[model samples]
Target: MKFISVTTADGLKIIINLTKKIWPVAYGKILTMAQLDYMIDKFYNETALLELIDKGHVFYLAQDDNNNYVGFVSYELNSEPNKTKIHKIYVLPETQGTGLGRQFFELVKEKAIENHQKAIFLNVNKYNNAIHFYTKLGFTKVKDEVIDIGNGYVMDDYVMEVDILQ
Candidate 1:
């Protein structure tokens, strides 16, 4: 697998497509249809993605040997010193058990280390199955948060963190 830095408009568009493909499957059981629709529009819209990139978020697209886009992750330096916050990570449903998620996470860790980050953190919906996956990858739940993301939608998530130096 290869990780491509998403810096161009075309690359951002590809991430958008990947989001559309992955989000429904990943969140369908855990979130209501209305919530899914709202969150997708709020977070995955092209304009929003461009704004995030402009705000210094780095995105990487994961491609397989056949050049198929299997997953993607985005992260940025957080307000906390020496820490990075993963804003997003998603893999194709079919690729979920094939170790692609781990590969993607390793890439994220490499990027964080390159940026001199001492720790990496992410938020996972409390009811999402990915929580177990993150735990298996050595992330520990630090705190629970219920973020009011507008439109009557709230994200009930666990703030998971992992010390990269370990």
Candidate 2:
């Protein structure tokens, strides 16, 4: 698969739609539909995505040889010293066990290195097995926090970092 940058407004909507589909499938069992819907509306709205895109955040579409979008991710400069933050990463549930996520991270890591970032960091849901995947990619847990997502809902996440300069 190849990664393409999101360049059109419609492209961002497609990404968000895919994200909405994947979110419930991925987290519905772990979270209530009410919670999931709330978070989706609160975070994935067009305005929010447009803001990120405008700020030059990197958003990638993982496309097949035929150019079908199979997955996507978003990231941006981290406020921490010499680090880049992976804001979101998702692969379609139907496409998940195919090593696409690994390839996706490899591409992101290469980009980080090219930008001279010493490390990369990401936040994963506390209940998700993605920690195993991230660990396999050399990410080590650095901290854990509950981030408020408006209302009374919050996301419990494990913050992990991989040192590319090591």
Best by lDDT: 1
Q: Each prediction's Cα lDDT score?
A: 0.89, 0.86
lDDT of 2 at 5: 86
TM-scores, all candidates, are 0.95, 0.94
Clashes per model (N, Cα, C within 3 A): 0, 0
* lDDT tens per residue, model 1, 1-166: 8889988889988888888899889999999989998998888877888899999899999999999998899888863788888899899988889998888788879878888889989999999999899999999999999999999889999999999984
- Model 2 global lDDT (CA atoms, 0 to 1): 0.86
State the lDDT at 165 in candidate 2. 65
lDDT string, candidate 2, 1-166, tens digits: 8788886788788898888889988997788889999989877888888888788678889888887788898888654777888888999998998999988888878888888889989989999988999999899999998998877888999999999964
* Cα lDDT over the full model 1: 0.89
**Which residue pairs of candidate 2 clash?**
none
